[model samples]
Target: MPFKPSRRHLHTATYVDNKLYILSGFDDSIGIKGIAGIAGKQFFYLDVSVPFNTQEILWHDLTNINLVPSHIGAGSVKGGTNNNTIVLCGGRYLANAENKASVYTFDTRSNSWSIPTIIGESYIRRRRDLTAIINDDGKIYLFGGSLIGYNIVVNDMLILDTINLSWGKSSTLNAPIPRVYYGADLLPNQTIIYIGGETFVNQSLTLNEVYMYDTINDNWSTKKTSGSIPSNRAGLSAVLGLDGQRVIIFGGYRNNRIISAQDSLYTLNINTFEWTIPKIFGNIPGPRCLHKANLIGNYMVISFGMGYQQSESDILLLDISNNDEYKWVINFNPPISSSSPTSPTSPSSPTQIFAQKSAAAIIGIVIGSLISSILLTVGIFFLYKWTKNRRIQKNETSTSDNYNLQRTSVITATNNYNQSSQGVISTTLTNNKVYNHGRENEEIMKIHDNEDNPINDENIISEVTEIKNHGQESISVNNNQSSSIQNINNINNIDNNVVQYLKDEMIQVVRQEVNQLINSDNSNNNY
Candidate 1:
């Protein structure tokens, strides 16, 4: 609800105690010559719980703290003993330097950052744009990200025990290929689900495979998911629903010939491994990549990112209290093309209309049958009760089953009012077995990989603010290199390809819907 942070991408935002904190990132507006400047030292936060229109929402800047120059692809998490601290992991500094394997923690209570500590063995290279997740045990898991300067992507898994303050490598068999800029989320089962990310083999390749890692067994397995899979893209935001049964995936950039951002929303049912695109109502945010999404209560908050036409500062909220449908709302509407089709709108084509009708008919039939069964059962129950009362008073006897039922009812009545009144339906059903926290912790690990440019040959400093002026100068040198310029060109070409790919996918989806509608119509005519 506060004034949005400066326009940037590759930044991380986490919600803690109803407050949102945004870390350093890249701001294209501060480019040196023709190269973009990385805003690593800037930090800001807002009290998200404040009503939007009541008070003037203002961003509180805390950029004066000494911080490492790690902007792009940095991994961050908020989970300490108090759950008030934020931990930032590996990332690059500048173009000439290597990726950092350092770790830093920010204490909200003290309003200070801990000294940077190098993580892992000397042989382990620093990485950026990696994903990180913290389990109930407070251990952070680091996953795939790229090495600085080199095109190498590391697939090795690393674990940082926050309690002991030590790093250990996870020996996982059959891990996914090394990647960067991928989307990841921790499931209720304690397993981590990794989605799309890009890797460099001979050249840059985007991946679509789903990789699942079992923290308990320290093993990896590829899941065969059904339904319409989304196109391969990097920097997508994935968040586990409050119920932890479903995961919501939002916008990301598809690197092809041209960089194109996606605006669609997809959901994955963890139990069934089925992906579905639900119709969202309200104002939808435009296509963007490198944004952050966090699950707070029943709302999925989408923060800053780079849009298709420009950078964005708006926040989008996707309400997931109801799995049957979704509602999208944004904090503010930034100026974009009026012709853009990213706004939330119902599917209105003939095919979509027919599908809706068919679904409604099926639901109506099921409801009618349920009501009929309930009425019949009630009638029989009343008749039996009357008959029993008429003749069973002398023969009536106390039974253990009846006593148990009475006890259960008494217990339910006593505890019902104590349950959470957040208006959200509990994902865990009454019939489901409750799991202990220790067992859930043993089931999963969190892994993160991100990318950042390392600063030239300078000693990694205790005072990170000293290198703030060096960022622009380093970008100027990077811009002069022939190879660097060529790489930039290649990235632009990939973006073009992304746009074309999105267009083709849209056309294909429309065609498939039409065919399904035609088939349904034919079947009805035959009947």
Candidate 2:
């Protein structure tokens, strides 16, 4: 009980149900079957709920207790939705056939290990050394890392639904390219932040991009970052701040060396997407990489990682937590508990009432605003349609009336026309006419329609020809012209009696056309 797990770099640890569960990692150790030397039952847990000093702290070693077969680490670690299960997925193989066993879980309640019956994990064996996180909905999201048995990093993202015990691939829009050894942390808003990592070429190179994933919408986004941002590096460690609005990142490898402690400490404001070198005052921990930082309240518990040979950079066992009073301590303290009274006699305070009322008001405002927006949009759309129809009708009426009225001048010398107010009309004619034989006069008549000619309005019926006569020229003149031409005694003039008969026949034709037009207009209006 006095001894602790061996110092290791590539191990995995996470807090669940007030217990910190540790998993397998790489160290100076031998392996079985020529597999991972870092693989073994290097797994353990510490009850952080109980108070203890570092000197007397007990590490519950699960190394021998119902040993998990193919126990491996440096994979993704997340607490289950049930809140008691710790899930580990994708890591260096501890067994020769570790491909068949991609998942290993530990049940704290049963004090036992298990490999949950999963359904969709067929190519999951190929995924290795990836980072994992669980959202409130119990979905485990795994991101960038090297593929199993291969040195190249992958660009793939896989999701494990903890509720259904199934695996699926993420179809992300604009996801980040393949990389590995990056630092990642999940925000309370179900967003994941991926910090600097490296991708392989002839050798590994730093990936400076900051990738953000929105789990709700299944999209990836990158935003502009400002402030004193740290230089791009990989193999760093990131932990969410206790405030739930920021993330603190620690040392990583950069420029072929561990980043110095002086430039190692930085904070990212999740709300603002800004970075800053936080002020610290104490024995600063040495520069390191591939480490893990766990936030326990006001202090960050930084674990083991690789370091430089300089004495200042030789050790990384320090608490850079508060960023205000940085220190190296062997003390473990319980977080201050704020317990509310559960007495039945306890009355609700004014503050609580006000908060409830304020919440109700905000919700009401949001719902009301949404409904109003929809109604306003609908109203505008319908109004536009109605106005368009009305305009169309008015144009059609104007065109019919204008051309119809102008046509009166073509038919008679007095130039008179009449109709009802509607677009379809009934016309009355005032008869007055005079004609001279010396003048060459012709009139073109056309009927207009409401088609796509609102500007020039050329949508018209074929032109009507002015009547002229050589064999029947007598009917071509007006009534007075016809009467006056009958007295003329010329060799070209037709017999007087024949001219009279022709004039009478022409009048009859004119009368029939007028009656037909009036009937057509009446029929249109009725229709």
Candidate 3:
């Protein structure tokens, strides 16, 4: 009786090698003067095989052997190669705060405590009221905890490989709501079922809504459960049944009162997620909340909780060997499964792994498509600007070429006019003969630079020649006629304006001669 554990709640009980190993917990109320709650130092267990009736029913106190750190509300998972290991981490408050998430491990075989070397980045040190479960591969999955400060994070699913001793995060999306004070356990396949928890707001949420976490693929989903769902509860303990297919749920904090006298026992089928109450008989334990339950062979042994009118050191066992007839028992005949019921993580389990990875691949494809579209838009914008600039440059070059060609055409026309001056080109002449040029003619002097000059410094003799030849094209015919205009008036039926060269004296002489020829045609119809 000297080794018996005092009245305590928030302690941890883990089954290892047929022994119920009980660890640190809080003795007083957690809310007594802020964070001033007494942490229990006693660490012991009862070899469940021999208990109560025999002298062998005694607590093996390992309290004085090696000083174990006191912790309250710490998450502990039973694991290891031989399955005699308990990995404990985080708490409402740990006595040793320096290396909070060093993740202490206890070997029940040697009864030793040691911190394994962590390989990679763990991100956060410690958290309170977090849920932890170890898979068959010895990887501990930590999720849903209360944060210590801004630095200490337990937010995303944290993973710790117990074998290699490495730390990492799941980085999984669509996680469950952040909660505390919940009971979580593996359900047959590496699929974990977590139920009965409170939010950060201190409001007790309904236990009807449960979430299944797939540890293999790192994802969370809500499994459809039917048949008499439990009410809103907290401080409830959910232990996997001895049958290995159902979760046995027991006493919880219900409607402002602790479930003490009136016992609550329900069975949730892990495969179907359906809840069913098994028949009960024979002195069910009364007035307990925030307790830990472990299935040993044919009995459901619950220990260490806030219980009234009962010795904390006393044993409470419910015999569940008979499927429908579950009665309280002091001792068990033989333990059901050799393996821990909580450790459902086996070699072939969790079929939910592959489907989630396919979804991740789809997300990756969408991200790649978005990046490609951005690059395409940028390329098209640059190409359009380049085309517009090139077109403007081409237009300017074309205008320059046209100007050069027009100037070259005007120069060629002026040279042709000088060459054709010798021939009496029969063409009409008028005051509208000036060429309308769009550009400034820098070579205007070229027009006046012709070899055959239209006018010299002084030349009135050429004007007389033009007046004497006005009557006829032949000089002999017009020489006798002194008055060249009078003979030209006798001519008829002639309407031709002919220019020999640019040497037509001031143009007035030619105009007057032409007027005389027109008057002759009108005056005398007869030639």
Candidate 4:
């Protein structure tokens, strides 16, 4: 009961000239399968400022006119820019051949109905539940309806010129399949968005798709929107707002079962081809199908639905004045003026109005600031930490370059491991290493003076041992002992044996590590 109910089974609604007009639908009527029964073909109007919770709507009984019937009343009660009249177009009469291509008008100033002369070539007979939309240019467009008994549906788009009072069909090319009970709305760019609905086929299949019609190009296109799309349904309510840049849709029925009636609101952006789940708060009206919603000023007046038991007569007014806040304050008052629906002939307290607006603004500002501060703090902290870490990394990298081991120096420090002709020739020929290690009676070593002058080594063997213990490469090499060592080096060569031994060891280590990594990945995958 988040959304209060005022009346039920109200079919079509439209807002024009600061008033909401709700038109004919049914409530509490039993289906007789073969025989037709009476329906609630009543039209009611309310001042846009009235809060919805008020009972006893200043209802003007438009039902007394022998014109409208209770069946499937599709289309809208559109108003012209400079005109005071509201127009209603083709829908079924719910009873006999009464379902004709009938057009009617409501003069707001006089608060009465005037049945207009039918303008179409052949009257749209036996059709029910079509879509009607009025563009900014003051022309009304009607799309898609069905002949009830024959089950024939038409996809032709028709226009009713408000200025000329004449009807014309679009000469523009191919169109979508003829469908009825589909949700439709006009975008600011004059593109018509059509959502899922039942087809004209014998089977009542619920479609999950979206199509758009361009009024200018006379072309149709499809859209693949993200997030949830409402299930295929008939009798759902759709309106263009959140300020004409977006569209909001609600409640519908499928298979005679009511679904998607939650207070959830979905939005679509015209410029970006993106859909959004806007945050809505406060009281949300429950889902009900066969109801019509009209945008009056800053709110939507939703009236009468057949989704619930007892065919509700609840007239719910939804105030979406704050689109950024994404909240809807609903009042379930009977048909009344928008300004004072709850209080009859009473003015809102001035102090209360000021306090409410002031509190809302304060709350919005506080929430906005908190979110901003959280995001700003996170960004600043990360930036500071990143800068500090980057500086440390640069310092570490510079130090390593000046101090870490170079491959050439490391090899030179290992005595070049060349003590024979074979070792000497391998080093000179390929610059490759042999891994054999051995003790030698004679070893070559030289030293440099503090002034960087080459100094002769007094004892080659001892000097070489000292350099080996340093664990760092020595550049010193003996010039005098080179000839003497060359004779012994040829006899002591073991290059091939050392090279084979090292290769085997390296291969073993690489195979072991690769096996370990693969095993680890497999275990993680299993877990």
Please write out the lDDT profile of model 3 over residues 1-527, one tens digit for every residue: 46656667777888777778887787644432124646776788877654353222577887875445676777788887767788887775546544455477888867888877678745656676666787777888888777665433334677888788778888557676777777778766887788877776666767666788888777878766778787777778777776788888787776546765544788888777788878888766666767787776677778867654543234577777776768876655545444542343356324434434533443344334333443443354346435544654464455446555765686687866445333222212111121224324322111122244322222212121121122233322122222332333332112112122222432344344334543543344232
- CA RMSD (A), model 2: 23.5
lDDT of 2 at 489: 29
lDDT of each: 0.62, 0.61, 0.62, 0.56
Q: What residue runs in model 4 are displaced by over 4 Å at the alpha carbon?
A: 1-10, 29-36, 52-58, 69-71, 95-101, 118-120, 123-126, 171-174, 201-208, 309-313, 332-527
Cα RMSD, each candidate: 38.8, 23.5, 32.6, 25.2
Question: In candidate 3, how many Å is residue 308 off?
Answer: 3.3
Model 2 TM-score, all chains together: 0.58
lDDT of model 3 at position 243: 76
List residue ranges in candidate 1 displaced over 4 A.
1-4, 31-34, 53-57, 95-101, 116-123, 201-208, 256-263, 308-313, 331-527
TM-score of each: 0.58, 0.58, 0.59, 0.55
Which is superior by lDDT, 1 or 2? 1
Which residue runs does candidate 2 get wrong by more than 4 Å?
Answer: 29-38, 53-57, 69-73, 97-99, 202-208, 308-328, 338-527
For residues 1-527, could you state the per-residue lDDT of candidate 4 as single tens digits? 12222344536676655556666555345442213455555566665554434344555444555355555556764665445667877665656645354677776666676766545646445356787877766777777778656767877778877777777776435566777777788887888888756676532334345678887776778676655555557766777775777777767767767775463356666556566666777656566766776665565656667655443335655556676655555444333443342222435566656545643543344334434543444354346435644654464354344333443465677766563422211111111221214435333222233332112222111211110111212222234334433532432243333334444543344335434543543444344
> Quick one: best TM-score, which candidate?
3
